[model samples]
Target: MHALSELRQARRFVIKVGSALLVQQGKPRVEWLASLAAEIADLRKASEVIVVSSGAIALGAAKLGLAKGGRGSLADAQAAASVGQVELARLWSDALGHHGITAAQMLVTIGDLEERRRYLNASATLARLLEAGAVPVVNENDSVATEEIRFGDNDRLAARVAQAAGAEAVLLLSDVDGLYDRDPREAGATLIERVEGVTPEVMAMASGASASGLGSGGMLAKLQAARIAERAGIALAIVNGTYVSPIARALDGPVGTLFVPQGDASARKAWLGGRLAPAGVLTVDAGCAVALEKGASLLAAGITEIEGDFARGDLVAIHGPKGERLGQGLVEYTAAECRSIRGLKQDRQADRLGYAPRAAVVHRDHMVRT
Candidate 1:
């Protein structure tokens, strides 16, 4: 399959720009960004695009006259990120602005993506931004991120962002065009055009950490990212960003190594099924169980019991009348609110809950069948 073409055909995709591509000599590459922005403008005509960029710390280090290669104390790097994030956002705004596109900046920590409630919120924000025809430029919350709470590199972060946004593909723009059998510097080294899976052999072929001081990750990190994308049923590609119109070229030619997806659960379902532990349980009546078997959402009228304390957006176990676990889903109401509206018909729910009730206590789309 033509991997890059798949990205072009995707309804939505993410593009990751490494610090090495965005920053040179501690300065943002304005012309390169403009070129990329132009390509993104064309892609946006057919697909929604999100950008995960790295450069804030690098730019900040330069501005603060810190040592090169991001060599500094954690406090210094954080200080640099604080100063550089504004500049990074401005650069993206100006680049995309030239094409009449609006850029929205989003900063996220590991916890933001790991926590169920925060994950839902982040997903909603990304969906809203895309629906509004705005390109969301995401980055690690470097300013506030300690080493323990950080992604350590943008590659994995981009993959997570793609999964969160329900993107079909991710394009990792790096200094190298693609994965090589051996270091490209060595003779006879060949670029692997297509990767079916990130197996142990593939990981072994990868070399040490990033030689480019501006970036933190290397081929290993990218492979880790591809694995994440693979499980989320999202294709990922690693391509050279040094070339002009990289996305356009990748779409039309063999310009990168594409990692195939494993066709597993959707991102939301994956999280609902495995990533999170259920915060509570909702016991539904016999009729409700039958409705669920027919693919109906869990409504308050069907819910007979609520156990444990769970807030809105928390994952909850669904039990049938026989107390058998049916599935788990994200609950739309807090435990207290759910208790107030439990067993109420749609028309009477608002009276007990003191607000217009949602159609489902747990939406079918948000549920994962065991």
Candidate 2:
């Protein structure tokens, strides 16, 4: 349908670019990229921007004359990424530099986002880069990324990055204008403008990978990304990047499928704590319950017993000594670790466990008081 008002009002957001739009016929489209950079420069004055770009492997392989066209072995792909990353970064730097804008390259792997400590650190880095007035151009570390750990496409990565970066919206710019009932060129295919929710029916409309060799994601990946972004209370727009100044146009017009969130950030946090069933239950003493009421974390010393087997990062219900449920939160330590440290002095946790963990069993940020 039309551009969401939230898209235009976003003070911070992500713009994802795929390889097909960045390159054509094994050659970099410098002029198109320069124009896009100009738009980014203009957007930066009033709002913060983070770019998730994909093109290193394609441009890199083409430069080295490696497979004539498609991907080679994992080793060959990583080799291409190692070489192309340099050129890709340089080109982005030069283009943005022309507009007096600074572009910083931050290559990340799946581990960086999946691990709790690394996730916080990576998010802080991106926040700092935006605060310093430099646009962070994020790319997956393809060189060493195995299939098991790989994001597979930049679309899902962009969605995850949007959540971590605290971005209000995510703009996915690809060759397609928006999502359709089917392939647009085919008869009876109709453009679906706004996706209020990503349902089984909505997912059924999605297709496979892109026909273009330069790009990896198709509509399916973008829809999958929209689901992730929606859960994090971020809106995602799937827009066409085939034109110059795509970002601004997408924000100003009916350019793609806009998936709006059903709730705000606080609501999303509430959902995280209670929406999913608790993996396990945790029993804490009275003092810990009081501390939780005062907005403190669940420390090991405060917990008297662990009720079930739950891995780290799993949601757990917190209970008072009398078996009264206090609330739920994400646990930082596994059940086995908690078993060893339960009732132990908080300060002596490292000595007992042989390694230090987070000071709190569950941080306030991940805990919700009910």
Candidate 1 off by > 4 Å: 266-269, 272-370
Steric clash pairs (candidate 1): none
Error of 2 at 95 (Å): 0.7
For model 2, name the residue pairs that clash: 1-193
For model 2, the superposed segments whose C-alpha errors exceed 4 Å read 68-70, 265-370
In the range 1-370, model 2's lDDT, one tens digit per residue, is: 1355458678898999999999787688998999899988887877899999998888888888889443667777888888888988998999999988889999999777755567778889999999898999999998888766687789988987887789988899888888898877799998898988888689889887685766668889898788777767788998888898887677677567899775554633624532324678889999988989899989899888888889998879999999876778899999999988998887788887888767788888888754
Candidate 1 residue-wise lDDT, 136-182, digit = tens = 99999888888766788889889888888999899999899899999
Steric collisions counted per model: 0, 1
